[model samples]
Target: MRYYYAEHQAAYRRLGREGMTQWNDLFGESWTFDDFPNRVFLESVLDRLPASGEVLEYGCGTGPAACFLAARGFRVDAIDLIPEAITLARRFAQERGVTVNFSVQDVCAMPVGSKQYDVILDSYCLQSIVTDPDRAAVLAAVRDRLKPNGHYVLSTAMYDSDRVYEDDFRYDATTGICYERSTEPADDAVQLDNTWYLPHRRHLRPKALRAELEANGLQVLSQQGELRGDVICTPTRRG
Candidate 1:
């Protein structure tokens, strides 16, 4: 697990340096790997949040959503594990004329001091942290940083009902890790080849995801979508 976490960190650092630019060039600036339903759902709900509040965005890639929150009157602090990503996010925030505290920090081991947030947003990055314990640590950190009435927004891919492995990818049942080897090879930031590989992707079952959240003291208040699930959670009362 430690080795995989190290690998994950290294992969994202490389991706932050190269993959992000390649993605913007290949897919254009608006090229986000988001499903329309989830994206729409998130924007609609987030936009309706109180005009002013403290917000924390975990795994904020290049700062679009974080900027959006900051622009919407929230005191925003966004963190990403990759230093290059933080650099890009800071530049993007500056370009957008919005203020965001963007920092290079690990989600599992957040570096926040006594500060807490009223809202925490997780957009598809929770599943990227492959190992169960690591994911649990992140959830616990979120619990610790959130205000009593604070909410956590999570969006993630759902496991296919049939559990059929796509030609290019395979899900390991034992480790709950999904690995990919692309057949249509091309020069890309995340090289999906025999030797080079992309980061681990986890497609979680809705029941399992909810259970884990509950175990971490988060209670699911609502959820939306099928192919991709967007859930809102609130911290549960502790004895």
Candidate 2:
């Protein structure tokens, strides 16, 4: 199994079993109401959205963003690869008193069955897709499921130019891949220099990342931040 898939499922399984509601527990960040809505980039995204329309949130974990949009009267459809995450997402929507269509499916392989959304969101999911093919597939899915004038909103961790990689984590600037060193090797981990390294998130320079989005048919309209960037884009139209 892919490392991210397994890791994501494990997180959700723990959340569901522990009765925990928050999904943004990674990196010591708690995605609560106090922080999530007030995020600068997130606020920008909210400002760009239509007053009311059909929306899809790709890789929605526990339905925070989906429920947030739905509570304000936007019809929301969200999907995640983990069934556990979807179950908890349904509960989260209920707790928020909002109705959201939550499905358990990989965004890379989701069937775009005649439903084009006005807006599609990728909430911190793109960086997790490190492989070229999977990243392209997910972007293609976003393009295929979007209306002609639909917007694609994304939040991702960017390569911090000021930070230096050391200790357990190091970055390969050439491939734009980050590796987490571990004592034990995962089935998918790479063994180099007698150390087991797991393929972690991809943190591309903003310019390079934008080029990728464009290559995959998304034309970025605007972006913000350096270490963490939030982008809004639309599908590119070809002659």
Candidate 3:
């Protein structure tokens, strides 16, 4: 089974430099934690952040989100698994004169040296950890990195039912490894266009996710369905 780290590395390579440029073009300004303009998911999360506090954004991509938070006067730390991504994010922050601590480190293996953050933002990254086994360790690591009363906000796709693909799917929740069979069609089948290249699909149901959080000592502050999108979970550390 492919580990989460390996899967992410492949994705990073796929994005390469061109993908980063595309992201900058699409977002215009640096991305923020709760960035979507009219989405209730981000709006609710933004409402929870302190005006100025220590913030950590996991999977910060090209650093747009970290830059945005820094511009707002919050101390920000952003991390991504891709070295090139972190380099681009650092350059972006430097050009914008926004001070953000950017690093290339796996969130599960972060060497943060016992530091805890006031808010941890996981904007669509957790869904990438599709394996059930890896989820526990990742959640535990996140919990350990948060301070008392710290907030965690995350958005991820949810699946209503089980599915099987023409290809292979493998996931391990213990290590958070998620693997998928290639979407390529077999011989004798009609040549499928790459229009629908679904990379991975392991979704956490809202009820199940809430139960997981509570079991891990996180208190759900508010959870809302996001405009026909995935459910957003905003939870606070138990004091």
Which prediction has the highest lDDT against the true structure?
Answer: 2
Which ten contiguous residues of candidate 2 have the minimum total lDDT?
Answer: 33-42
Q: What are the TM-scores, per candidate, against the unseen true structure?
A: 0.76, 0.88, 0.70
Residue 203, model 1: lDDT of: 77
Runs off by more than 4 Å, candidate 2? 37-39, 162-166, 181-191, 194-196
Worst 10 residues of 1 by lDDT: 185-194
TM-score of decoy 2: 0.88
Tens-place lDDT per residue, model 3, 25-115, is 4445664423532234555566667778898888777776677778888899888887877877787788889999988877655553688
lDDT of 2 by residue, 207-227 (tens): 888889899898899877655
Model 3 TM-score (2 dp): 0.70
Each prediction's whole-model lDDT (CA): 0.71, 0.81, 0.62
TM-score computed on alpha carbons, candidate 1: 0.76
Q: Is candidate 1 or candidate 2 better by TM-score?
A: 2
Better of 1 and 2 by lDDT: 2
